[model samples]
Target: MTILKNRLFWPAAILVALLIVNAFTSNQFVTVRDGHLFGSLIDILRGSAPLVLVALGMTLVIATGGIDLSVGSVMAISGAVACLLISDLGNQNSVGSVLLIIVIAIAVSLLAGLWNGALVALVGIQPIIATLILMVAGRGIAQLITDGQIINVQSGPYATIATGFFLALPVAFLIAVAAVVLITLLTRRTALGLLLESVGGSPTASRLAGIRSRRITTMVYVVSGGFAGLAGLIYSANIKSADSISAGNLIELDAILAVVIGGTALIGGRFSIAGTVLGAVLIQALGVTVVAVGVPPEATLLFKAVVVVALCLSQSAAFREKVFGRFTSTRTEAIA
Candidate 1:
């Protein structure tokens, strides 16, 4: 009963329910095609990779009571940089060149993140306004990098990042897993998690305790930007092209939603990487479920809203007490 009432339990149940629904809708929803994992389930994992990576970074930022609105723009910039370079290369298929280009793209995103952190931590600007400046300008910058045109590349190794299979799993999914593991170790294995929580709970209090809140806040934005850069790479590789206008459009919002749905409060404090991963997967699965169940294209957001509302209600302790507690009381009385 205790486990059932847990906040994460509901979302897990909902995810399983969605999976069951998918299984019923299609005979091969969970199949491994041609000895490789290429099913609807795998598709959800691949599709969720970008969102999961972004949400992981968002989780850290939210833990510090800050938001990075510029993540989408960072992603746009990263993808634009990578694809533009690949397009310019004489040997687009060279793995080494692609690797170097990936590093350069991510480096640019880190710089963008540093820019955001400096504004928020040093200039005392609000997180929203500080990131919003870049959010608005980032795409324009990406457009400039791409010369107002979409850049397509024919790099086989670059494409492998998104489409290749690794140990019977999508490489994109594996990348997201690697990110999740890195974050988990960084927070759980170190004192950084507590420091972040302390800062989020009260920046002034953390500063008084000599926590260096400013540096912490700035560091999170940098990490967020770097993760967004990775997401950008996966996204552009999935399509084998980069369009400045569409690369990471509104991804920040989705990442935020995933973080919240994963049980991280917007007001900051404690963070949950596992929850964020689950939330990202759930959201992506919802989209796949909609298509599997034949929901109309225009009604997609509506369906997602209904599901999100359920999750919100489930997360409310008071709501759970008022609703499920009564049932438990009734069952106990009947047994007595």
Candidate 2:
């Protein structure tokens, strides 16, 4: 009963509901091709990678009671950086070329993150306003890198970063797993998670306790931006082209939604990486359900909005305490 009462329950319920619906609605959805779940399941995971990655970062940020609204822009910046660097290689040195491009992409992403950290931690700017600066300017930087045009690259290794397969799983899935594992290890295995929660629970108290809440808060944003940058690389690699306008449009919103739906309170102090991943999968599955049912993509966003509203409502304290409480009491009586 307690497990069901936990905040994670709502997302788990929705995820299961979607799976049941998908199983009945689409023949191909349950079908497995080779060793992988084909059709909508694959589509769900494929479309989910970028959102999952961003949400992973957002999980930590929200844990610190901060938000990063500039993730989409960071994605744009990183994609443009990778495309430009790879394009410049032009068959220069093969292994060295690939290493250089990947290294530059990681470096640029970290730098972008550091920029966000500095402004928020050192300058004492509001998180939203500070990231908004990058949110607006980051795409322009991407445009400058590509000269305001879509950059097309025909690199095999680069393309594989997005489209490649390893051990019958998508590379993006592996990356998402690695990120979650690392973060889980960091937070659960060390005092950092404890400090983050302490900070989010009450910044002043944490500061009084000698916790560098400001630095932790800023570090979350940097991590968020860096992950967004990595997501951008995966996205562009999947498509083999970089279009500034379409690369990461409105992705920040999706990532935020995922974090919210994952049982993370937007007000902060709590984080659930597993729940967030489940939420991302559910959101992507919702899109697949819309498409599988022959609904127009135009109406899809509206449906998603409705689902999101319901999910958020279910997360409210009143609703959870009421509905879940009643259900639990009823079950207890029956058992007695």
Candidate 3:
């Protein structure tokens, strides 16, 4: 009962249900092919990797009582930077060139993160407005980098980032897992998590306690940008091209939804990386389920909206109490 009541329980249940549905709808949904995991289940994890990365970063930003609407734009810019550099290098296959391209892309993302942080932490601008500036401008910048054209690269190493297999599992999935583990260790094994919670819960109080709230806020945005950059790399790598306009189209919404469904309150405070991962997986699984069941493309978003609404309601304590108060009362009386 206690486990069932956990915030993550419902999302986990939904994921399981979706998996079952997919299994029945497609006989190959759970098969292994050529010593590699294949089918709808693997596809979900592979496809969800980028979103998972973005959600991980969003988790940190929301934990700091802030949001980064610019992540999608940042992702586009990251992809643009990498693809443009690779296209110009004339040695796309060279390991050195690939490494340099990646480094430059990450650097650009960090700078974008810094810019966002400065606006919010130093200029005292609202987070939404601050990030919005980049959200609108960053895509244009990516277009400028690509000269208003899609930048395509023919690098096997770069493509491997998304499509390659490692130990019979998708590399993208491994990257997401590694990111989650790194973030978990950084937050739980250190005092940073508590400090972030303090800042989110009460900025003034945290500052008075010498928590360096501004710095923490800035750091989180930077981290968010970095994650978005990595996600962008994965996105471009999967397609072998950088489409600035569509690289991360509306991914911010998906990331935000994942964070919220993972039990992280929008107003901030507590956060759960594990929950966020589960939420990302759940969203991807839902999409896979919809496709497997042959739901009309137009109704797909409607189904997602309904599920999101239900999940949000389930997370609402007041609503739950109102609906289940009688049952709770009866259970307590029986216990007495």
Query: For each candidate, what TM-score against the reference?
Result: 0.96, 0.91, 0.95
Candidate 1: misplaced stretches above 4 Å? 325-336
Write the number of the candidate with greater TM-score, choosing between 2 and 3: 3
Candidate 1 has a TM-score of 0.96
RMSD values, in order shown: 1.7, 3.1, 2.2
Which pairs of residues have clashing backbones in candidate 3? none
Quote the lDDT for 300 in model 2.
Answer: 84
Candidate 3 lDDT over residue span 1-336, tens digit each: 577568988888878988999999976885777888888888998999999999999999999999999999999999999999888877788987898789889889989999999999999999999999999999999999999999889999899889988998999999999999999999999999999899999999999998899999999999999999999999999999999999999999999999988988788799999999999999999999999999999999999999888887877777877878878898899999
RMSD of 2: 3.1
Q: What is the lDDT of candidate 1?
A: 0.92
Residue-by-residue lDDT tens digits, candidate 2, 1-336: 667657778778887788777777787764555775556666677778888989998888888877888888888888898888887775833766876787788678878888888888789887788888988998898899899998888888887767666877777877878888998899989998889888888888999999998889878887887889889999988888778878788888888888887777788787778888888888888877777777777888898788888888777889877887899999999999
Model 3 C-alpha lDDT versus the unseen true structure: 0.92
The per-model lDDT (C-alpha) reads: 0.92, 0.82, 0.92
Ranking, lDDT, top scorer first: 3, 1, 2
